[model samples]
Target: MDLKPLLNKLENYHTEKPNRVFTMYLNTDPADPDQQGGEWRLQLKNGLNNFETYLQEDGDSDEKRNYWAVKEKVQHYINENERNLKKSVIIIATADEDIWFAETLQMPVKTEFFWEEQPQLRQLKELQKSFPKTGIILTQKDQVKYIDAELGTVKDTALYELDLDTEDWRQHQGPHRADSNLGSGGAKTSKKDELAERFEANRARWYKSIAPELDQIAKKHHWERIYLVGPSDEVNDLEQHMNKKVEGKINKNLLDHEETKVLNEVV
Candidate 1:
């Protein structure tokens, strides 16, 4: 598809609110219900009037309409306050598999990381060493505490908050629990329950893990807003919990794209 029109729309959208950072999340997973998996694109706009027209003409569905609405709101906000758009930044997060597709399409690729088998602390340390400039750790809610400790000393290390519905956790838990029951049901259940209990017991650890990084981001960038986007149920739940803890410091939004699709959109 020709992305010029979309790009032009985004350009106009951005022009309107030059001060607010503009972040876009695209679902790249082939299995994502919302995404028609393909090459990703970024469209910068100073406003959304033209983009809204294009979306209407493109015949996006009701769900797509919601996406467009959010996009338009951001666009409109930018348009109304063009003077404030200078410090704005655009960030896109997606799956590792779609990174190639995004690169192949020549789309702008920001930071890229995937869920791995090792503990989040190890992963964070490795990532910090590699991308030393990175100040924010985007991860599943369950790993926040681990990530916090891993990069606590690093300057400007903050956790981006993402929300996943509780229902999604319930849906995934059946199979997760089933797998837990396999071979060593009792032992697995006990271990899993123990982990959950630990998460609950030391919830402050999770917040403290990224608190320093968040402060740095705010201080250095004068960043007043944060956008979290991800698939992990633990991450989503933790985001909600942290929002309460951090109070005015964090801004949380739940990305509605399916797990798979999230990669496509962000990557």
Candidate 2:
């Protein structure tokens, strides 16, 4: 997303007039902060009422209209955009009854309103510093698990499952010593090398098959960052085969950690 144009536009906008900017950071999640604890609807009402009180005291003649318009707009935005009801909402508007920006964010924000010379971009900056849209791909030799994870709020939901072909990976004793050149150590070494090569080939094939699927799932989830957890060889192979989007967003892989402990490692 290109922000230069938008930033330039905003810079040009407020310079035109004393635009009464209203900044609201709302806790849209049903589990509101303890200070405003109640059911979701009640919490929303309380938040808006708090804003209304502030505007009534600090605002001018058009304050009532601003209160109603902003209240309706904010409520409608929350209802329309929230999916998991685990996200917070940020709305920046002008007293001229124009909504400058509104966004549903994965991480929670303290419910507060700010009246400043410029729009409140500090919160946005903080959010960008700690992005919440992330996905986890935990890969082992034979099985792959995809988890939709959010960094800030510790949200980890198992989304899809991809079980790869495991036959080649399974352990099996090589041909009996008698089957090889009898009493020949060179023959045993040759057998071991052959088995290792075949195992590597099978693992390569597995990587090739699953890399695209993993990429597709990450795109589907709109993950801004991807965390890989797997063996060193497999992780390296997957990185080479991953699509440009996945490759660009790859966070460091947890090659030293087991698959089961990825959750602990990521958060």
Best candidate, TM-score: 2
The C-alpha local distance difference test score for the whole of candidate 1 amounts to 0.32
Kindly list the per-residue Cα lDDT of model 1 for residues 168-212, writing each as its tens digit.
111121112212211222445665677556555654455455555
C-alpha local distance difference test of each model:
0.32, 0.57
Give one digit per residue, the lDDT tens place, for model 2 in 61-134. Answer: 46567556756776777778656455577787765654467766556787776654466666655675576466
**TM-score for candidate 2:** 0.50
TM-scores, all models, native as reference? 0.24, 0.50
Candidate 2's displacement at residue 61, Å, is: 4.6
Candidate 2 deviates by what RMSD?
11.1
Weakest lDDT window of 10 consecutive positions for candidate 1: 97-106
